[model samples]
Target: MNQGQAAAVFEGVYARRLDMIHRFPPGLRALGTRYIEPLFVAIGPYHRHLPRVQEMERMKRVAVHQFMQDTGLDWDALLAAAGVVAAQARALYDIPPAQNQGGDDPAAVQVPEAADQGEPQPHEQGAGQQEQNQDGVGPAAEQALGAGVQEVLAAGHHGIPLPPLPMSNAGFQEMLCIDAFFLLHYISMRDADNVPPSALAHLFYSRRSLIDNDIMLLENQIPFFVLTHLNELHPIFLRPFVAKLATNFHGHKSTRRIPPFQHHGYTPPHLLALLRFCMKEPVPAPPAPDAAGGPQQAPDAGGGPQQAPDVEDGAQAPAPDAGGGAPPALDAAGGPQQAPDVSITFTAIGLEEIGINLNVSDRNRFTDMAIRKRSFGPHLFKDPLLLGRELVLPQLFLGNVSSNYLVNMAAWEVCTAESYVERDTIVCSYIRILAMLMHREDDVHQLRAVHLMEGELTDRETLDLITSLGKHLPMGERYVRMLASIEEYKLVTWFWIAVHKLFYLYFKKIATFFAAIGSLAGVFKAFELVLVKKHQ
Candidate 1:
């Protein structure tokens, strides 16, 4: 048979063998083993003998590692254990003599039956010794004997002769094996918190093969060929592959440049959060203004109402400003161009639509926790919430930040974002913060200036802003600490204390006023009642 035909036949036979073996009590409980064993045997010989099969197997192995890593499996250690088992098996049996029989005359039947001259054993030993001198059994012979014993044992237990390995589940196993390698490659290539873009890109492309192979398709349409049976495989062996991906893709970018907004300090935490919300998913514009036309535009920073853009969504109307107010800040020339107009668009795609619930904790946490354990940290995978949702798309944040604030905050400003831009400008916003903290010169002073700018913020507002910004900025923990420090500082403490005292005094006055009003009302009511009674 040609290789493909051989593969097909092998697969069919092995699958049948697996189905039969799985009927056994113990093997049935081990999970995936029935399929695994036959799958291995079917492909193992072909992998060794056929060049095409070998190449595909290698690719499959790599792809398996990658898939396992992505799925958060410990593939490396599992494969290592498998390797040890295979090596021991090989040492014990060099080559099966039965295999040498080559699909021919029923494998040299060695039916153990009574020998006719068995009673003459005493002298037979001395004769057997002489015979041993003529033909000494070596390791190879011993191995053959061992194989014979094993087959007999197997037959006794399984009630069937060990069939030639077939390729029943080759496609599935091959995919898993390839996934393991792909995962390993990514694990090895990872540097610090950042995953190599090339690696991400490569894995993304390689993943298509799983679908192409279609060995074990799932109802969900997610290729389950390898990962589908993850629970069936040895988790201990699978963990390392999962861990490596986690460690390698940590939140902070040690080498890459942070993106523009946070790097240049154009938008503070609040505006940044708003900008992020806008960039998350594109929103369809409000439906073209009705026949009467769009709502009236507020006066621009230049003191004249500018025409609003036509909206395409009939349901959404932009919130009207209370007054025709000017934008937040003005340029040196007092031009309207200096102020950024903040517009947020939210297109609601239901939770089911994405197959991931924004509110569900465990499901979201599992993917992240698995990655984190591998040592990537929160920075590797951004998790603004403990249970992560709202994945931080760096490109979107960067693009929006740039478009919104470049002119307002120049590169020369001694601002947080400017410093980031000075370094790697292509990296994500959070990564820049991490890099700055780790490697920047005059870090304390730079951060102090940023802190000064932060002082204008209210406690509730500032806290919310910082937390939201943490979703995308690699320096989430750092920002959290910095804000805590600001709260603890003597000036901030005094300010809070003064505010608290003022609140106490104000409440006291209001309470006294209410008491006085109550007394007057009571007296007035008594007087009115007495007058009415006298009149009656």
Candidate 2:
């Protein structure tokens, strides 16, 4: 590597606190690039040269013109404003020297650095107008900001020498400015009632999924700071846009579950980061089980042979005193709650085969998941009905579009693994958990039966997708913790699982035979009625 090039590589790997935007690592890319690489459009330099995505350049220009018209800013106003933040934006992306397309060219990019990366205005200004530009250029900002058409990149410890952008400095600024426009216009037009007058908005309908997929790709992001900066210049309340997103993906519950995007309270490095935050928002624990049909108590809890609290993974639960402490406790309805004798490795069907049934979670986010105990029927009959413990999973739509978002988000998690603590790999962890549960087509069927999984993807396709995604993810804390939780649960409840297994494997067939006899009797009765009518 040239001295400058090597330095740039150093900056990406070692210089910054965490370089947030990145090219998804090729190691993981081996898993699949269908969604990793842009399929329809390119937002940043990473995939701008793809021939298929090249066609979308005109659309971006169209977005630029529309942005100019909507903001009522002259080209020079837009250029200068966008130019100021360019350098810092550039730093977040690690363009290895070989791919430093903008190598040695001076151009810059950056965005708001504070809450949602903005300071609250004591008073409101005109739409899109900012009283102060927190994004105003600095020594760091100048490092990446190109000198438009006039100035060549001056030699100094200016930020990483600009990649010789396919767009010279001026062209680079134009790309950033217009890319912001594309994202902004897309959001504003996401509303159903907006009824886009032009074909541009109409095009979104036909290509909506592809568009969503493209913008959200880990490699295909524009800095969120740029979005914030542009919003400062041209104000658009994104409430409606986010609301539609909530309604589309989640149910009509609206923004109740979705955290709103604001300028002051939250800041994202880019769109993917924002989405990661949204999807990983912690799901509240289900209300504590009431004593009536509530969960059987554990050794750690007040009551029975249940999972020990905070037990280390793979730890063995001590055997109940052979001397016979009081027998297992009774439920509210006086049903004997069976203590598990032993536990088994689980699949989705295995859980059902034993007793824990899958159920749909209340929220729409994939990360909004939990293992809950809810009373599905009479306490006396809970085991027969599969009513006690439930694995609550959110509905994954699992179409090309959702798949696109998932793979890309997981890709982001994998690529940015070191930048995050183990708990932060929510998406990757969630996907892996699903793969663990779903061992085959029957497992996918179980998810479908409860609406835990949905969309156009077939059962096989769904299993394939989850399997592929889960295979490549490094085990994150969330995944490990979940496994521990399940293991601990099994260690404590083995007796209960044994009882259920016996009844299900043997007694249930007898029960089915009796049920069949009852059905046969009903059929005979109906046939008698028909004979009488014919005689009459």
Candidate 3:
């Protein structure tokens, strides 16, 4: 270990791309490990040793046999190509926090379930990884929960090799091949009209819900590069598989066709990321101000019950100036990166009271939210409004099946946010937006009534999940801007709102007075009837 070697390590670690998959940060584990940990199966090296998922390990071998049999691809050729990819990807996983230092130091942060199960919970470096660490394409320096490799790199030290990987290269390559084939087979058979052949029928049918949940966990992911490399070597099944995952587990009976996200040039980091990319449409540019000096209230050209302005799926728009206080920002991996809370000032009922109606977008995307000032023209709600604004948003389904996935997607944004990233921290922002507009069970009821949300979850559960999830997330740019716009809308339209509130209160009081009179009349009639009976 010399100065030159140390500097080279620093450069390699510093210049590398961030980890493709990571343990959900410690702050988020309080939400429950079930939200982030895989419940059914492990897809990569991180969770392979867990006793709970070990049953599925045998299933992977079955997958290899089935995949080779079904596709008629040569096993030796697939192995050679995938093995090369495994070498390139060995450095992609995050080094466990306890990699270098054994967890004997009572202070190390332990992953709750992993620690108790005796699974390698990020403690003590394995010797194998260090020997494999030669200069170029070496394992990356990662930010483990408390112990950051970046910190040591920052301080400048003699070259010390990183801790060994969780598994050796030969073992890693085999794991990738098995895992990839397992997924390919799973996708090919999971939604077939006919019963899945053999063991797959039981594996995918009986545990369908749990397996779907596991697939979306951030920690339980393999690098997307492995899938792409395999795709290059003939069996190009990644496209429809990604589309199905993104479309919320739609039936993937045919993988040979359907080009939903394939043409978009999206290189997702993992399956969960692919889902996010599919759910996201780039934020649209703000409407330009008119000669009247307000955001132009353009008429709906596309006649619809609800429509988010059509834009190219790949169109990237910068965040509009919020026009208020400093909005919170998410930072890259490592260090303190939480933004201050920006609460939505209005609830669903409150918005309705102020004449701001919520509408669902035709395309269900997390990034879809728009505020259009009411103008005298043709509209999606069918009637042109002379006053009030239409707040358009995408429909969201909240239930046990989607809850964990939604939370992890938000956590992913927080964990992987980079300095030079886009303004949309979508899932978190969307959750916060929901939280901002919902205050109680009645608010959730309002959402359902308007078709903004639909799921098996009770109103209380939906309320609890989004509100709690919102508190944990760093406020996203999209959420911040929307909050600001609504706040500004309130300020400019205060006169109209005050007038509406006054009339609403007056009408409500009048209705209450009439209801009281009707009650008194009923009581008098009952007394008269009792007197007549006594006289008889």
Candidate 4:
């Protein structure tokens, strides 16, 4: 090869590094292959020609025809526009050329069987024609291409009215356009008044649960740009509607309210990313410096740092910097120190035993959580038990599809080098936290009783799901730090529980003596009332 060609190829390879759609890493796929595989339909070239999913291609053609007829545009016009940028679109997927090529030569192609020609014309016998005939481009594909296009294909570029394209190239681009239109239509018609029901009846009535799940698979996605470009040619209004539909569809009722398209800076790479964006919470900024120029101490959700009262009866006090401090120093040799194993020894039920209340919060995202102390009346010798922690976590809807959706998102975050450890670890951290909390089916039952998890899945299934997620992905540094914080928090919480129990024990005798005094006083008052009645 010439130097110029080699240089151009090298540059192209470098440029494609930032492509959004990616193949699943081998580790992730091994954990659950079905999660990444498309069930009902394939949107991109990655799964386009799979034997199992090819039936949907016929449905796509029918949907495309209906879409064009409804929108008042010709099929050829749409195909021409798609053809103009077909090469660009093809480059977006990671499919190998050999797989797409069925021995079709770009220089020549066949006339469709549906064409009016009775016999094999002399010019139609090229290598491309033989390849197309062998590939069996189906009745639906031929009908979609139409007789005019086939005639142009049979006639060489010299005499043809349109630009030359291989049958495979033409078919793939058509597939992309039709698939994108189907998605757009499905999303836009959710609550539209003017749109006819007949236009989307087939899609709405199909195996919706399976299709909905498939659309969010990482490998099954087409780039958002292609959908947008196709939208421009049909109806421009559907663009924003697509985003709104996506926001409502994936999370359903449980999703956090993300602002409409204009205010948000996030541009989703595909459907899965779109759903992930909807659930994301904006990270709070660092606290600003005070007027004296010292670093400001961040307040907890309760508006101040939580303080634990002094321990009675000579118990150990919790370290003031337990949750916030750096790791202990290494030994004299300056090597890494091996800290003693620290873990949460208590379960959710154990916390409840010490008077801690587990309540589910209204927040839609799982990462939203806060621990606060509940207060009681002052004059009544206050129960130290009231100081027990109230754990508030976001409500999650768990079901059959939840595992697939979550695992793929977590896998995407782990595989992409561009993903930020702190910002993008939301799903990963949430899953890890679940793994830490749920040791068995009983833990799942505890969470469900508090309304923290609401769905059809049983406790055993939930436990299994948590177990699977924890095993597959490597823990990030941020997650490690979070684990340390959780351990410290657990230690502090246990200390308070111990202190509260001790204080209750100490006060029990004084409370019993007071109760006896009150009973005697009541008896004396009743006797006095009886004497007064006799005198009257």
Candidate 5:
């Protein structure tokens, strides 16, 4: 080979060497792939423009690869299989030199440093430094950098370069944020039993650091991490934590056996499911501004700023049938005690047990209960016949009537019934059912509560009942609003309808029996009179 051709071939081989970069640690693999790989390619051709420095970068890659392999990580398999470095080399070589893109200029592009190579050195160059080439430029001299090249270099140094390193998308970012959120959500939550608390704590701290500092990583890779941790977190541990959520949160109300969730009045099943998923997963910290003008931080974790304790003192026991009767009397110590007037504690539990989507049996049971009027009967005001017992009231009503208007109407109907025993059961059950239905990833319960409380008292039956109850019962000032809320749900109408229907049926039965007895007496008297006439 000619001297120049032989020299060019050797330079190319040295410049494309892949030793140094292959020696990174295992933990740095994802980081390297996400940030460093693209950068190597970007500067690869430029290095060739200055052959010696390009060779140095190639050597760095080899060093990184070796460093990584030393960790004994399985990630090495990824590199060997992908041939990512080789592909990058091929890509770089395929692109013609900048000068070659246009007509060839007789003069080479001479950078300024080469001209100053004749000057005396102020200080000795560091070890491994290359001497000035024939062009008179020291290999260590800083090259003129375009803005784009500078960005790529910056990304590399910060561990966020492009190419073989995967980039993040909006969805991926959201998932990361959610993962972080759940990590905190699970840890901050109580009942740490059977959980690897230390592992979770470390994970939260790590994720929090990444979130707080705004570290870059592949968005798609986040799900795997989230699922791994989430699988370890048991759903049972969240129950007591959620129970505490109900007591402190204003809109949340306790249901019977099943727990309460955050309520956003009109949320659908799909939305609630998404919300539950978020609660189960890690919650992400807020995102910050990025150098690229993209979000620098993760999205806000969806929850209230003031999280309540997951447990409470003096908490009443869950009632047998949801909304069985009035709660027991409260003693001076602010605890529930047995009351003579109220036999059983009212619970909202039945509402929680009922499925969001009811089957035919659920519908039949609810319908039969709704029609039954006797308080002592199977589906009435008995302890077992609680508001949410037969079926989830809000869910049932929602299923039967397919509109917002119908839902609101049903809610009003149940709330305004006259029988406090019956009315409260329905109202409370409806509230519990609605909360389960509307458990959004974010707290949306207040909106639903507010809507259920709005509007003027238009229904005469409810208005009259509210007026009557106010006069007879020694209700406090708060009771006015409470009754109004109950009235809005149409509890009064249901109570009166049941009472009137039962009374009407009772009178009809009595009348029919009396008429039959009177006919029998008249027939006996007629027979006696005929016999007397025959004897005379």
Candidate 6:
């Protein structure tokens, strides 16, 4: 191609948004590919030719046939609809076109398909056949496996123009439509009792966990638009059924409490995107500035006095002056005020000792939390003291798959949508805060005690999961400020408790000494009275 043609192609590729799905970065993949790559099946072009995942092609063919027959949809009609949006769907994937040609690769072993009941196809020869020939298997063994393979392949050819096995552009479009249809049908009928039996039904039932894991992978996704278009072309009754299936499969129950669709204003791009969206909390607008251009102070928990305009939750607060002079001056540019001490000296455990109850709230929406005073107690010389300071945290669920899923989502946000990092720092900030809180196994245990974490993993495992997932995440300026504030609050609380204990000890010692002195004086007075009576 000439330079002009090359430039035009480059422009065409770059100008469009093809970043919906991405392969894990080198650092993340270095940890392990098991979590990022599909293990049981390949749903999209990225993993279509992987040798290990080729066996699933047969199953996809079965699903396509069963789905078409049950729904009574014409095969050609599905292909025609998919063809209309083939280019649009293709643009959403990041894989190269050349990778879609499956038969050329020596490592990719295609499953053998026989044309007749008793005879194998003359052209078919691959790993399964080679094994059969070498083993000299009996006629019964050959008939059973061979008949199954033939049935699968026959269904592929008759049901969908594009089978899961790789082919030309036309075949690719058909693959998109068939794969999407399979997913929709499977999820929609997963709970139904009257579903017809097929190869897919058996695979899905026997290896449900494996299939679910693979489908959730970021790379193993078809464009949502393809699924939407196909659903639209189908019967009206099926559209809502498929949509509800998608929502139930991807949406978290905690997030469903507050519907994201109402707030996000746009539909999620795909299944993975839908799951990510459900987990996302609406980013609160930045707090407005006061007349002096500093953050407005919130009333103290006691509600008797307003504290120095409490800084925004994520912004840095000016360090309190040691000399008790005017509050440290706000920065001229309204940026974060410089603090004398930014180091974190305590953990959640320390905060707990200061009469702060660290209870897990039902709202596990990471961003949802508040610091509040639960009660006030009378003081000798001051206004009622804020007695119970509570840190209400959303319940965090950690499990075997939690780290993998969360890290991938965060990576997607960081790599594809840079603007989201600035606007919605909740995911990054939450991870960082967790990392900070769980610096040791004890921290995890403490959180578990408070029911903040519900997981079967050991304390060490929990810490490792958080640390590994949170590595390399950018700590936003707001997040830094928030940490600084928490650290400062911890230090102040620790000091007050220490001072109170010291005064209590001192007063107790003084009272004991006075009591001893008073007893001695009474004894001396009694002895003097006895001497006076003897003299009389």
Quick one: best lDDT, which candidate? Answer: 3
The 10-residue segment with the lowest total lDDT in model 4: 107-116
User: How well does candidate 6 match the true structure, expressed as C-alpha RMSD?
Assistant: 13.7
> After best superposition, candidate 3 residue 447: deviation in angstroms?
1.5
lDDT of 3 by residue, 67-180 (tens): 665556655665677777776676777643244343221211111111223231222445422211221112332322233434433322332322323344555666677777
Task: State the TM-score for model 3.
Answer: 0.67
Encode model 1's per-residue lDDT on 314-414: one tens digit a residue: 22332221111222233465322221222111111221121111121121111111011112344233322222122211211122113112111111011
TM-score on alpha carbons, each prediction: 0.18, 0.67, 0.67, 0.64, 0.20, 0.63
lDDT of 6 at 254: 29
What local lDDT score does residue 372 receive in model 2, on the 0 to 100 scale?
Answer: 52
Per-residue CA lDDT of candidate 6, range 1-536, in tens? 99999999877654543335565555555445666667788787655644456557656655665666566665667667778888877766653333334433222222212222322122243433333222222233334344433443454335321123323454467568667876766664554443556655677878766776677677678877677677664422222222232332222442221111212233445666555544543333334555743234332221111324432322333333222233334476644464667654446776655545566655445545545554443332221355435566666666545555566666555545433222345566667666767778989988888787766568988888777766766664334555454555556666665654454546678778899899999999999999999999
lDDT of 4 by residue, 1-536 (tens): 89999999867765653455776666665565577667777777555534456556555655565666667666667667666667777776654342225543232212121112322221243332222232223333444445533554454223322222224554466556667777766654543333566735556556566666777777788776676567666543332333443333133452332222221334456667656654554222323545733224432221122224333211222222222465334466643233357453546765565545667655565445545555563412444456455565667777656666777777767755333233456577667656767888989988888777767678888888777777666654334544455555556677766665555565677778889999999999999999999999
Off by over 4 Å in 4: 1-18, 99-171, 192-195, 236-263, 282-347, 350-357, 370-387, 417-420, 476-482, 490-494, 500-536
Q: Residue 224 in model 2: shift from native, Å?
A: 0.6
Local lDDT at 488 for model 2: 51
Count of backbone clashes, every candidate in sequence: 53, 37, 6, 0, 71, 1
Which runs of model 1 end up more than 4 angstroms from their true locations?
Answer: 1-515, 524-536
lDDT string, candidate 2, 341-362, tens digits = 3232468877765666777777
Local distance difference test values of all predictions, in order: 0.28, 0.58, 0.60, 0.55, 0.29, 0.54
Q: In order, what is each prediction's RMSD in angstroms?
A: 26.7, 15.2, 13.8, 14.7, 26.5, 13.7
Off by over 4 Å in 2: 1-19, 96-168, 193-196, 239-243, 246-264, 282-345, 376-380, 384-388, 419-422, 512-536
Itemize residue pairs with steric clashes in candidate 3: 98-122, 98-123, 98-124, 99-124, 99-125, 129-164
- Rank the models by lDDT, top first: 3, 2, 4, 6, 5, 1
- Error at 443, model 3, angstroms: 2.0
Q: 2 or 6: which has the higher lDDT?
A: 2
Backbone clash total, candidate 1: 53
Worst 10 residues of 5 by lDDT: 106-115
Displacement of residue 202 (Cα, Å) in model 6 is 4.5
